[model samples]
Target: MKTFYWLVKRELWEHRGGFFWAPIITGGIFLLLNIMGIITAEVLGASHGIQIGASGALTQVIAEMDSGDMSKVGILLDVAMYAAMGLLIVVLGFVVFFYCLGALYDDRRDRSILFWKSLPISDASTVLSKVVSATVLAPAIAVVVGIIVGMLQLLILAITLSFHGVNVWQLLVLAHPFKVMFNLIGYIPLYVLWALPSVGWLLLCSAWARNKPFLWAVALPVATGLLISWFGIMGLFHLPTRWFWTNIVQRSLFSVFPGTGSLFGGTPHNAPHIDGLHALDLNTTYQLLGSPDLWIGVVAGAALLAGAIWFRRWRDDS
Candidate 1:
């Protein structure tokens, strides 16, 4: 158990730049842009009575909260928080994609796999460590960094609003930082489950490809789809080549919240009308967890992961 833990830790240590620093840097850039926008808004508002768009909306929401109805304010901030998280998720997803693509291949390319294999560890453990790092540890790190960066950004916004005579406490009341953080944390497990198939597939390619794992990871699927389309085999099978690509993309992107409508699916016409701070509902989470697609993907991912381990054990990179 301790060895497994250390293996996972080693993966994190090696890929800290991608799994850790990338999100932090991206969040820092977002924070800087937000601060600069606030400053610009203050200057413009002072000279021309023009309101900063985001702050103006927030200020209005805060004003409405004085009337004893704080729900709208909370909902607005919740949506904003989700928007920020969505951006961070996109960045994290890309990092994990490339990280998995190269996880096994890089060791062999640099002849480090020889040293790793000489250790008293099995290939399964080594591959599992990379999988856990990409799917679980990497996302966890990104989420924590994102939450911290979010809190800091909101704190700055609150202070800036207070300077303009907007009540900052009202903003905090609406923010519901604890609730937001909890929901974001809850998303981590769902994301791991949702993204497993893609991650496992990448790991398989990483272990199996003799060279250019990225090309194998990306090109093979695309080429297969293209060949099927060109040969009209897809038409005969009643499965369009586009469906193959679309399904993979949707599975990769939308598996996080299964019952909830996806960004790819377009907003549902019957979407719930939330009038208050959107706390993570246990019922909705239960429904998402019960999804058949989620289970199917998990099974597929497990098969691919098994293939990866087997390939890594037998393939001689040197």
Candidate 2:
């Protein structure tokens, strides 16, 4: 158990740039932009003879917020948080994607695998640590950093509102930043499941590719798709190329978490009208858990991970 902990820790130690610094740097930049926007808005208002300390749209918005309803504030805050999180997700996704692509291959290229293999760790442990780092640890770190950045932005906004005669307390009471942060955190475990197939496949390519894991990881699936399309065109077989691409490959690669709309309780194309703290719906979670595609992907991922372990164990990369 201790060895496994150390293995995971070692992955973190080596890849802290992706798992830690990327999110922090990205979040910090966004927070700075938010502050600058607030300042710019205030300056523009002043130029237009709008008193910062006078009742205006902000006051009206606050008045519309039900004094008894906290969800209104939460939803309002969610908009900003969602925007920030959206960027974070994009940046973090790339970070993890590239991290997974290089996790094993980089070691071999540098001849560090020789040293790692000489350790007491098994191949499974080594590979699984990378998987856990990519899926679980990376997301967890990003979420935590995102939450902090979000809270800071909210604080700055609240202070600005107070100076402008807006009811800062009411805004804070309505926003429920803590609850929003918790809700975001709650999505992480499900995200890991959603991302498994993609991450696992990347690991497989990382472990097995003699060179350029990135090229092999991307090219193989694309080539497979092309081959399938050609076969379908020639009437060699009945292939639902579009369906397979959309439902399987795209789902694995792009759907970081299935039923994320359920988290906000809205359709994918429409934003949810946040009326209250929409706690994660267990039914949606259960639906994902019971999904055939998810399990199929999981099985496939497991097979790929096993292959990765085998490649790591037997292939003489040195």
Candidate 3:
């Protein structure tokens, strides 16, 4: 267990630039842009001899807002929080994609695999450590960083509004920070389940491909998808085209993205909510977990991961 912990830490140390700094840098960029935008708005408003609350209309609007209106503001801020995190999650897809695509092959290319192979560590432990780092630790970092960035975003808004005398504390008070954190962080386990196939598939290519694992990982599934569509195989087999596209192609390629439980095909259009603004909140996730399709992907991803482990042990052209 101690060794496994260190193995995961090693992966973190090596990939911290991607898993940590990428989101922080992205947040920083957006923060800078947002600040610039606010300054521009203030400058323009000043030129017009009218600021946000100069006419007293904005202040009166907030003062007149009832509980229902305040709740609406809270919902809007929750949405802003989601938007902040959504940007980071998109970066995560690209990060984990390339990370898995090179996780094993890079070590071999640099001859570091030989050094590791000299140790007591098994290939299974090594591969599984990468898996845990990609699935759990990566998303956890995104959620935490997203929360921080989201709060800062709100702070900017509050400060901007404060300069205009519009009861800025209400803006901060209406936001549901605890709920936002819960929802963003809560999605990680479900993301792990949804991401298994893509992670496993990319890692398998990383282990098996002699070079250009990215090409192999991308081309294989896409070629298969094209072949199915070109031959009209699904029509002959009485299966919807979407079934293969979603299950076979997307599971192979895009399962790394969150909210992919929709591919599982068990949740209703009107599924219940579990205290999050996202369509794929806990309630919807619970429903998707019951789908046999999801479990089948889980099994396939595990098998692919096992193949990755096996290949890493023997395939060493690099």
Which number leads on lDDT?
A: 3
Q: Say which candidate scores most in TM-score.
A: 3
The TM-score values for the models, in the order shown, are: 0.86, 0.86, 0.94
RMSD of each candidate? Answer: 4.0, 3.9, 2.1
45-139 in candidate 1: lDDT tens per residue? 87997655346675676555554467656666666566566667878878888888889899989998999999999999989988888878887
**Runs in model 1 lying further than 4 Å from the true structure:** 49-69, 248-286
Scored against the true structure, residue 256 in model 1 reaches a CA lDDT of 33
Residue lDDT tens for model 2, 166-200: 87777776665666676677777777776777877
lDDT of 2 at 121: 81
The CA-based lDDT of model 1 is what? 0.74
Report, for all candidates in order, the number of backbone clashes: 0, 1, 0
> Where does model 2 exceed 4 Å of error?
52-71, 233-239, 255-286
lDDT of 3 by residue, 1-318 (tens): 999999999998999999999999988887888899999989998998876786778989988989999899998887877778888888988888899998999988888888889999999999999999999998888889999999999988888888787777868889988878887777788778778988999999999998899899989888988888888889988997777888888888888876656644556557554454656455555677777777788899999999999998888574
lDDT of 1 at 279: 27
- Report clash pairs, candidate 2: 73-174
- How well does candidate 3 match the true structure in TM-score terms? 0.94
